[model samples]
Target: MNTPTRTVPGQFTIVLHSHLPWLANHGRWPVGEEWLYQSWAGSYLRVVAMLRRLAEDGATDQLSLGVTPVLAAQLDDPHCAASMYEWLADWQLRATDAATAPDPTRRELGVREFQSAAAAIADFEMHWRHGASPQIRSLASAGVMEILGGPLAHPFAPLLDPRVRQFSLREGLADARGRWARQPAGIWAPECGFAPGMELDYATNGVEHFMVDGPTLRGDTALGRPVGDTDVVAFGRDLTISYRVWSPKSGYPGHPMYRDFHTYDHLTGLKPARVTGRSVSSADKKPYDPQRADHVIDRHVDDFVDHVRRRLISESERIGRPALVVAAFDTELFGHWWHEGPIWLERVLRRLPEAGVRVGTLATARRDGYVGAPVDLPASSWGSGKDWRVWNGPQVEHLVRLNAEVTETALEAVDKLVDPAGPRHPSGYRGGRSRVADQIVRETLLTVSSDWPFMVSKDTAAHYAVDRAHKHAHATREICDAALRGRAGLAERLAHNWSQADNLFAGLDARRLYTAALPSDTGS
Candidate 1:
């Protein structure tokens, strides 16, 4: 895998989208808050540590990072920050118990777990005590990476009412600015989802760039392409290179030497086995060996670096310019789902530059002129079939209809209550703003989130997803009805109650909802 010194090298960009829905007051264990804690400890902690190390070594423009507003809100929430600290303390206690187990295997796993847990606790105390905002802001401020922003609730843009879409997108960016002191120029459109005229909304919001699935560009992903007639660039994720790291059937993480994600030791609540074989039963799986996994990581890093080099060369030749290879993934895939992923990522980031490949953030790419001609991207997502099937398919048709109904009802209600000229609630304006209208907008945004239908279609926590959607829809309807009927007392009560849980973006004002007429085609 020697680099050809005679040839010019192309650029490589890694995009990590860090997101989870609002889970502050949600259920715990198997699915709710547990999901947040696991990813925080297993992935976020390690990934940030790796990036910090790289930054210390004078690294800059390392990767593009997307933190959706819904997830950002959770990361910055006081309740979530406190809960995560408690979870880490519990992890330490469990590791101690495991380390003292009578069985040798359990004891060995416990020893390893204890060491990891101690490191996590130290990291949490040192950098994550306040919340993720400071750490992430530092990374961006130091020029280590570019942070991406998204809509308030991560709604599927193409299916949302134009007004809601605009409001959410604007507020989401404002949320990021409030936290990090910079409004992101780029966004990971929820699920890499895009509709035809989204460029107009993006341009309206001053977005300079965004991401989409490679197929959306018809597979010409060697460079970023402008959407429609706007200068807003859409960088397509190169599935060809991305799948080499992770895909449906196979990936580097599936190697036999890597730690197995599914085989857990129920006694200690720690994974204790390697991926001996895809077909090997958990009971017969071999013990996890960190030394063996380290060796495997080194080899895989070499392989991936070579793959990127080769892809860059070939794509450059095809496109008649130095090509750009963008490999994007969910941040949780590392450390959380694939235990060795963070280490592999750090190595890849280090080795790529040494191998004569250019590494930069998406912002850097756009600024460096790694963009091509304009493209009229169609409705698409990175979901099943690279289309809207996972969101709008028959399996979740009910959710689609519900989203439309709730969005329409919410917009109409807000329009009536909010004075078009200013922020005033005709029925019961308090403190110069409509708290009731704000809550209706909040519930409406939650109802239209893309997570519910995605979970149902994937059959992962489907019941919980359905329950969340319905609950939010009911709240939205009730609040809207109360306010519109002049039941100010009831509306205020309901709004206050719902705010106990669905509270984030405290500065949100319903009057900010976009009221301009939209093109007919923008409807769901």
Candidate 2:
């Protein structure tokens, strides 16, 4: 008799891409690190709490989390570190404010819940400050989060000049080293944007695999594949599993009972909308219903598990072997954008096991021999039109032009570096000599992040994106010029000046970090 398969026998991987732009020192009180502080204080705290709660209850291990280098740098920054400490304390007050108007019995319960969040945020800050982030390190130690690496500024790697792309990934690797204090084994290729030739760079930096979207697999979403001759595996995100919780239109976040992302009460600067009511007017959104969201979470969790069950059975039948369902998402989708996100994740974690889905991280899947390869892939992006249009859209013409200059300038500087095989030892241009080159490489990568152009195109934070792209590109221009001219002292000066103004990704290599096999396009 054939053995009945009740679970997804192979594995299921969920990759959460965590990234925010380099927002240190660049903009002040309201916008920059302040925004970073909100994610750190609010979202990051919630994530850690959820992980601890799940792991404590024995859900599973090897949760794959890809924290971007730019975000890691801010987390380790003294100013950001200090600021986050204050922000957590501030979160306590907000929680208190949120709890004030509930019913008498519920008010008492709300206070306890609010206080619980307050204490957790405070404890999280304490651990992250004096030493490594408890969440980052503890999760990794438990084999809960198989940490994934990305480019220093989370740039669109394939569009960059090969050397700069190499430099960007290496520096990105270095950024991860500072926080987790360990090299990353996997990466969430920034934005799940995959270009055919980007895998060798991931291999060069010691990342075993990186993630991309489902269609890029040409229909095989559960398998991993090698890029070119490299051993690095590419994991495709399971589209069916991903859309249930947070798709563009239908998601638990859209349930009439969750906090609205669009309208905010400018006076209190809080989201004041009815969690479960139809929109009456923009001005009169109600004050968020916590209980209704809890109910919705259960229904959604059940639906999600049902989806996974059917997928597992169908895929297994097709492949003639056990199959995997890898659900990937942006981490910010959880608590930052979807206020009910953490609850949905908690319920999903709890429900999946009860439903018999063997929850796992990519590392565990790899360890268990669930890996395979299908070499060729078309050039694809996770952006609109599934192409480079997001990064090179009409709204970002200036960014395209600026990137063209930086790419050309940095490439020329790389060629000018002392020959590696020459009689004289090449400095790798270390110390002060590489400082200017470091800034050029650093600034260039930051400028080309698909995020700035992406943010502008989406109109989420358009002006800020334009401003940041120009600011970073300007620095790239100044520093790359000094490096190409062989002005060691001048290059060093520009590097220092930029650092004072924008000291992100501290462990950067000014010299071209990697050899690029891709040429950049100029006129977008």
Candidate 3:
């Protein structure tokens, strides 16, 4: 279909799920702090800049951006801010080194890298020294994007103990508020994982909406649906649109002109090659050219805008109502994985409006009357085959058992510390617990993060994931052991050591794990 000649009968929403595991002092190089810094330099910094540009152009609430609490903690952490500055400066120096290399192609790439690094350093010095929270806060305050919260540590909620799941959700929202200065009304549930009854927890926590996979709605995802009689709305990712940009087989990032994410120049620690071809060896890949990438981006933007226009027009007609098409993806896909992603994103957001395709945040779509009947959703995720296998399959069953044991151990230890007759608050945190309980809870959430199993199953940095899970698990077990045996001094020391090693959530209150109605009950 051509560009619309009449008013469209549908709304389009782009939801970018932003998350990274708690990577502050974890490790570096292939995993840990390096991963965080690369994503920050490549994606977050550029995306935030793009949002600000859009806001300056009078755009408001253009998309839903989910920032997980763990990531927020890292972004706002003072040490990460300082270390990231040093990392960026190091990157610039490496580029300078490459610029003098003997190879002409290497020198050309060095020039591009130098420019990017220089600008990033400038941006970091001006806005990021104080931490990422303020910049993110400003974007939300300006209504430039709808912020979506996820459970603390991005846990796989379906497998979590019921009360622990609720606690994570509650604490995650609290984390977001503490950092962003506002509570998100919606969440991009970690991995878009959902089971039946999760909506009830979301509703109780004041969440207005959350996202699920398209199949969760049984392929009829033209509109948001309330799940199981809750006022909380569940939107599904329209994969037809999302896959056009990212998929395993064919996606925009696979384009020959785009920078090859895998082909790095070790001398400078910079990516110097274009994809060239999927089957081509890295040594044979062509050098990346920014000008060529820009040309491809312009074409892709127009094509994408047209695709959205056509889909909305067709879907609205098929459903016989004003449809809501939500395209959701990982925010890191843009600049981190696909180097030209942020530019393409900026172009798409700008061009969609001019192309007569309406663009707004998920909340705006709902508020402007995009509603549907209640749906009883089955278990689902946006993972492999849209099922739970990636997180809970035979391949990662050991992690499943480990998570269960650690969760039980931590919760039981904390439950023993709660006072039965203390002044009770609605949030279950009124009665305080020992600092050991607080430390164990923090370790518990970190152990349950879905990243471990996912990395294991995908074999993408599997060792790092396993090491991290074991590290947190060991810390929790040691802390629990100390607390159970009445070794208060040892418990305090262990907690302090763990806190120094893997501290992310400073405001996490372990008391929140206790259910208010039944103070003694910790979920079985």
Candidate 4:
């Protein structure tokens, strides 16, 4: 399968990783639930709709979408469903307020927002009201996209305790199956973080493929390679292709014509300005024009297709075989951070196929017979320096300590609560004592999300990230203390409260943490 005799130079796959920390009942204003709702409206719903439209136009499995277990849980939460509906309605009312304002630009933007909010509300009511599962399931079932699963809380698995990592991976895949009604064959290793031997876990857990950063392959990433002796293949993202759309300094999103994400209309809680220019002040930026944005999208779509074409042709000639290039990014990058993202994505997907780029899902790539030799992957992440610094550096050392301590305490409590000698139930316990144990594990996982450290290191939303980490940590400690003290009534109350607030992975089993395949070490 590694041999490529075809005339085509390459195959292209786009990987979009979608994730958010558990934010339900956390806060409401500028930071918490608001963030979730915005991403839901701005990104998830819109991107899925775009794909569905493409599917209607005859595209199938054109890309791979990694929807982490944590995000899926929140999307399916009943509380989120009700709250999101209210949020969209509020959006419409705010747009009306903007429309009635004295400024013509504000009025135009408001009209656009009003239409978007109304349409989103209708879409939510018709499709997502029951839960995101049905909508997500329909896309996968329809063969529009391939789903990628990951840890329940999107923890940096390489930095986690073996038991915790293994447990979370297993539980996360289970959670994905429970929601979408199908098990995924591949996973988006949280943060694309991989350590030596992690692929063994992937192989053991039924993961046939996963993505790693291109550097992880040391420049030989034109094909998916097996990890060690396992059949679980690791596909390296082509950074040249991915960074073309989402780099720190220059990317399609930074273009002058796209809607600016940072500039917000304080009165109406909407962004009404175009980027205008890199150094331009938000106050002086010109109002956004969707028509102009659409033009820019078309330009970017052509640029990307051409870039992929040239790279694939060059690589195939250099390597003496057809190449496989993956352009991966966060799913939220589309409708959330980059306002014109979904439109640009649709154009790229459509154009790439027409340009003979062989657009397909990662699963399709593997099935189409591209393969390479096994290699030992180093401890790495897609973060700073392609290493563990962002998640483990000095700036987030406190968070690392916090995560380690909380995880240990949670595991200790579970070990004490569950009978060590009984039949290990799938949810990780024999029976009776599983409720408190389940809550303890849940809090622990939530506390250790990779988001906290990433946010802190990036300084994007550091304070909110800290507060979130502390909140989950506090809950874990309180629950563990109550359980240890034999305060059943108090522990039950605490668990119930936390459950209402951070409810995700409803079927999480704590016994998975005690599996013998994991190392005996308990520290993170």
Q: Taking the tens digit of each residue's C-alpha lDDT, what string does model 2 give over 426-505?
A: 32453233556656666777778788888888888688888888888788777766665667677778888987866776
**Highest-lDDT candidate:** 1
User: CA lDDT of 385 in candidate 1?
Assistant: 95
Winner on TM-score (2 vs 4): 4
lDDT of 1 by residue, 1-524 (tens): 96564434678999999989887787997889999999999999999999999889999999999999888888888899899999988887888888898989888888899899889989989998788899999999889999999988999988888778888888888778888888899999999988899999899888999999899888889999998899999999998899998775778999999999999889768899999999999999999999989998999999999889899999999989889999999999999999999999999999888888889999999999899999888999999899999999999999999999988898778877875654555575533468888899999999989999999999999999999999999999999999888888999999999999998888787766744421212111
Query: RMSD for each model, in Å, please?
Result: 3.7, 5.4, 3.9, 4.8
Off by over 4 Å in 4: 1-7, 422-433, 515-524
lDDT of 3: 0.87
Error of 4 at 61 (Å): 1.8
The CA root-mean-square deviation of candidate 1, after full C-alpha superposition on the true structure, stands at 3.7
lDDT of 4 by residue, 1-524 (tens): 56543335778899999998888888887788999999999999899899889878877978999999889888988899999999999999999999899999889989999999999999888888988888889889889899998877999998888888888988888788778888899999988999998998898888999999999988677899988989999999998889999897989899999999999999998999999999999999999999988888898999998999988998888888888889999999999999889988988988877777788888988998777777888888899899999999999999999999998898778877775765453334344546778899999999999999999999987999999999999999998898778787787789999988877777876755666442222221
Q: How big is the positional error of residue 84 in model 3, measured in Å on the Cα after superposition? A: 0.5
All candidates' TM-scores? 0.95, 0.87, 0.95, 0.94
Instruction: Give residue 200's lDDT in candidate 4 (0 to 100).
Output: 86
lDDT scores in order: 0.89, 0.71, 0.87, 0.87
lDDT of 4 at 82: 93
The TM-score of predicted model 3 comes to 0.95
> Which tens-of-lDDT digit does each residue in 1-524 have in candidate 3?
77555667789999999999988888887788999999999999999999989888889988999999888888888889888999999999999999999998888878888999999999988888888889888988888999999888899999999978998888888778777878898999999899988888888888999998888898787898888988998898888898889776877899999999998887778998899999999999998889989999999998888889888989999989878888888999989999999999999998888887888888998798787898899999988989999999999999999999999988777777554545442324325555677889889899999999999999999999999999999999999888777777788899999999777777776766654321222221
Q: Which candidate order results from sorting by lDDT in descending order?
A: 1, 4, 3, 2
Measured by TM-score, how close is model 1 to the native structure?
0.95
